[model samples]
Target: VRLRHALEVRSPTFDTQQFYDLAEKYGCAIVYAEDDEAPEWPKIDLETADFRYARLMSSKPDEPTGMTSAELDAIAKQTQAWAKRGDVFAYFIAGAKVRNPAAAQALIAKLA
Candidate 1:
């Protein structure tokens, strides 16, 4: 039996080689989160696994979609880079519960 696991970390304290080594040992994908609550790890140049995972939990308070065109473009480029080597699973989760789908769609368009 084979099960794939992805870890969503939310603190800067987890940003260490030890944590990455642990994830690699377990064959887990380290999630790159883009929420104010989670420290921005993807902003740094780090790759623990060929496959990548990302969860965008919130947009700016003023932006209902939680992302602007520029933001989505940048994320698309990042995801494209990951996709070049392997697979990338990205989600736009609007913590406010209103624009998640739209944000995701916009990102998808950018990726397309």
Candidate 2:
């Protein structure tokens, strides 16, 4: 089955190198770094999102799971902070929506 909760990284070019391996299994990817112009990501929106537990996709729990609650919270806070600081578009473009509608909307709201 095609998974909807996609993976997104904070610094696509920089952080991607660290998490791309972890993210490759997902349906999509996004990257928003500190200095990038527009974040690179495929098209996705709330209507297309579906949240799935990271453990379901993991063969090993010790490995990095992109959808962990902590990760989501951190990314949300960062996106929120960026938005409040007036870099809203940067946060949305940088964030990829693989399946988490709530988180995706949070990021998108910041963009708006």
Best prediction by lDDT: 1
lDDT of 1 by residue, 1-112 (tens): 5667888776677878998899888778888777666545443335677678887775765775568888888888888998987878888775655777778888887777
Candidate 1 off by > 4 Å: 37-45, 61-64
Report how far residue 28 has shifted in candidate 2, in Å.
25
Q: How many residue-pair clashes does candidate 1 contain?
A: 1
TM-score of 1: 0.81
Which residue segments of model 2 deviate by more than 4 Å?
Answer: 1-66, 90-112
- State residue 69's C-alpha deviation in candidate 1, in Å: 0.6
